[model samples]
Target: MKFQTIFKTAALAGLALAGTSALAHVGPDGSAHHGFLTGFLHPITGLDHLAAMLAVGVWSAMTTRRLWLAPVSFALLLLAGALLAQAGVAFPAIEPMIAASLLVVGLLLAAQVKLPDAVGAVLVGMFALFHGAAHGQELGAGVTLAGMVLSTAVLHAAGIGLGLGLKRTSAWLPRLVGAMVALMGVNMGLGLLAG
Candidate 1:
């Protein structure tokens, strides 16, 4: 099969599995208490959430080569993290890692530094794991979690799409994204430290 075909198939399969998994884990209330819209909006509702998702996209776009690999790596790793969290696995520094994602992603964008593509992809993948773990912890096992995960994936896609679209507009776009990410990092850090 062609590479493009394979990529599309994989993306669709991932989204479908995530949606089913999310719907399967509904709470004891017997209905989706959060509903679809709320679950869909969950990821983009907060600054931390928005920044992290967008950072994933920006970094993915910046790579310019092996672009799809970065987001795919993030999604797979994120699923692994979510599974770990659901299983009650212990991870010491999840919050700090999430905060660091924002800080690092933002710095990359602001400085317009072009990391080796592999390094950049790995960085985003690592951050995705932490972010996914947090979501799993909050949503638990259910349709809600699946829905939220799908929502997050879509949001990540949006960010990447935006970043790619904007890549030719100006040299400063990445830096601007980086600044926003940095601000979110600071906010996340405060929240993590305070709690």
Candidate 2:
């Protein structure tokens, strides 16, 4: 009987914590996003999206391609996904996908995996869709879209900068960062599931 109570208490506590970090969808109260500043700040406020975005940039910078393929692909596909969301298209398992993206990207960086440029682009593109859709679904106007796009680009650049800067240090630095990102992803994914 004591064990049962302990288990129940632990489970309840876990559920409560999970719910506290949820990235809830924009409700009617969020209709305040009237301009660029709001749009620019939106994605930054979401830890899940921010981590995933930064990982993409770091991975791309660390890639042999050393080109713009991954970031460009993310941008274009993100735009496409946003459009779909605006069109009222519903994607299944959106939150899970978003969380999984960070895990995948972080693991890739930690393992220092290399793939063809096109393939990498495709992988990041998939995540971009979910990320963009999260924002697009809540935004009924294009006024903020442009700002978000610009903000996304800036965030990507910052990640690239971080990756490049880390290159000057021991190889393990970026890998450590990747591991942390992956751990965060796991936390976010479990939270979403528990909630």
Candidate 3:
């Protein structure tokens, strides 16, 4: 069961990205790190990426069933997306969609919306693809893709841990965080549009 969980988590996270700006080992504009470090640093370097990825774990734990399914689904689909990017595939409005993902996921968490496990997982996975592709488009030989995936998994675990711990204290806090995340998404989307 533990192995399954780790595998599933890895599969989901492996697909995450740091957006175009954040996909670097050092700071986005800083000196480069190796492939794994670069991949690991990508998501954390970007607020949008961090918020969305963390929300996946929070939402997953909040679900009544299949706690790990959503993140895993995200990881696998993300891998496919990154591969597409590497192959020269392009997606439209990836940044806005990335923000929208935070909005949607956060709102869902805030609202305590429930779906069948598979359905929810699929929805999350769909968003992961967008994020992965956005970052993967800039993927260089500098960072290994595996590092990025592993970092994503770690983020998911952190999210899950925080969600589980917080839920035990005050459910409202998590919901509050969700609402903030949603608002941030809106702000980000609007900024994107304005620019």
Candidate 4:
């Protein structure tokens, strides 16, 4: 098979895995739990979180030469942020930054602006810190932390895979995805501002 075909297949598989994993994980009765499944489902359940996470993938796929590296960096940084949060470090602007990530990533994807791989990776990584911190805040300390981190890593991989798959499609695909992301971002922004 051709490279494109391989990428498409991998992408599809990744998305399927993500969707399946998401469906399998359910939230605790009334509170957040720190566990593999909970960690994975946490981001998937939140529209704002999902939009921003997926936007990271879409923007990275469109703009960066090292597409895979962008998401990897995001995951790593997110894990670090989670650790920090677990350690009781406070970050005041995490929510705003998360919202901004969605907006900026959406705009980048919509505009089809290609950024240097290093710059794109760094930006995504920085955003991941905020995302990770949010995740960590909800999870109590213990074995659950590790499980949650692992689950988050899987979700991040799934998003990246979905983006890579879309990249192999028609040129307009990214633009369409970008528009959707931007709309989601706007919705999230409104909600955040309201709250």
Top model number, TM-score: 2
- The root-mean-square deviation over C-alpha atoms between each candidate and the true structure, in angstroms, is 11.5, 8.2, 9.4, 7.2
Give every collision pair in model 1. 22-143, 22-146, 23-143, 25-142, 25-143, 26-143, 106-178, 109-175, 110-175
Better of 1 and 2 by lDDT: 2
lDDT of 3 by residue, 98-157 (tens): 888978998987887888999998898989998887667655443556767778888988
Best by lDDT: 2
Q: What's the TM-score of each model vs. the native?
A: 0.73, 0.83, 0.81, 0.74
Which should have the higher lDDT, number 2 or number 4?
Answer: 2
lDDT string, candidate 4, 76-179, tens digits? 88778878876778777776677677767777887888888888889878888887777777765555656555655666566677667877866875675666
TM-score of 1: 0.73
lDDT of 1 by residue, 61-113 (tens): 76547666666777777777767877877556777787787778778777766
Over the full model, what C-alpha lDDT does candidate 4 score relative to the true structure?
A: 0.66
- Estimate the overall C-alpha local distance difference test score of candidate 3: 0.72
Off by over 4 Å in 3: 1-34, 141-143
TM-score leaderboard ranking: 2, 3, 4, 1
C-alpha RMSD (angstroms) for model 1: 11.5
